[model samples]
Target: MISAPMLDHIVYAVPDLERGVNDIERQVRVRPVSGGTHAGGLTHNALLSLGAGSYLEIIAPVPGSEAPTGALPFGLETLTEPRLVTWAVAVDDIERRIEAARLAGYDPGERMAGGRDLPDGSRLTWQLAVRAEPAGDGIVPFLIHWLSEPHPSGTAPEGCQFVALRAEHPKPESVLRVLRALAVELDVNEGAAPRLIATLETPSGRVELS
Candidate 1:
């Protein structure tokens, strides 16, 4: 088994951002605050604080936004349901980790840079290494490296903590191997389909999102 990475955040993709915000608010009792738009202008998100240096991002493609070419990350365009489509993990040195991953037989793709403009007019720039194909419909995580800036998770609306994060897949062992390669560990249970289930403790007790 390879070493997996630490959890940075999870991505919940929806077609409409406002609707998703309402859904999470009603279910979790915590409103996600606007995090801003992606550099490609293809998607935007709101964030909720999940204690312990982690957070959740409810992302949706901006209405009428155009990604002229190439694939949008996280499969934002294809998401029909507000589901957990993908996740990210922090890396101390992205290039070094990329080389390591390649040597291990996994090409996580090249380091790409982008940023989003916050409501306050400030930009949160970051560089990430996203795999060409997010296997298992994003059950696998891409890599991220924040460029000397404060992470958004720390400043999000506070009131929740991740209780558990798990994976359900028929071929659990194979998925577990890829997760370990990224240095991420999630409890796996056999199931017909692959999905991620995240449990968060909030003022409303507990909220589970998959």
Candidate 2:
């Protein structure tokens, strides 16, 4: 099995929010809960618990909302279908982790504040390091530090268990180097393209999402 002790969440970007949630329910037999709108009102999300500290985020542009001037987060503007865009790893001290990554010859990007109001009127806040480098086009995860109590996974819809996560890349060695710099390990294999593949044990059965 792939070892991912720090896996926080995996981002599954879709073109439509509700449809994505419905499709997931059909497959997993568990409905996700609305996580509420993100900052800037550009997009909203629904979430599903994938175990203790990890969850799956289904994000898309807000219905009937105006698209931003630039490309939407996670390149949602151009997506024709739902796909696994990227993932995040939880960190205790984000700044210190950033410095450690930099010293190891990889910049995981700069820290940026991000928050979203829950459907219950409470708020969730966190900081994440957004990387400019492709980092294997989402295979190499960014770092995140949640500032709020009760992580999202605690309240998200349950029934799904995260089994494992792995990556396929054209240059496995290069991606391995970056993973080492980030101080994480994932089963890497040679493939035509780079993709992050996650396995889940759902109510229906075993399912794989990439």
lDDT (10s digit) by residue, model 2, range 43-108: 899999998689999999886676657667788777899999999999999999999989998999
Among all windows of 10 consecutive residues in model 1, the one with the lowest summed lDDT is 1-10
Give lDDT per model, in order.
0.80, 0.88
Deviation in Å, model 2, residue 26 alpha carbon: 0.9
Q: For every model in order, what is the number of clashing pairs?
A: 6, 0
The alpha-carbon deviation from the true structure for residue 117 of candidate 2, after best TM-score superposition, in angstroms, is 1.6
RMSD values for the candidates in order, in angstroms, are 2.5, 1.4
Query: Model 1, stretches more than 4 Å misplaced?
Result: 1-5
TM-score of each: 0.92, 0.95
- Candidate 2 accuracy as lDDT: 0.88
lDDT of 1 by residue, 4-46 (tens): 2377888898889999999999988889999988746778899
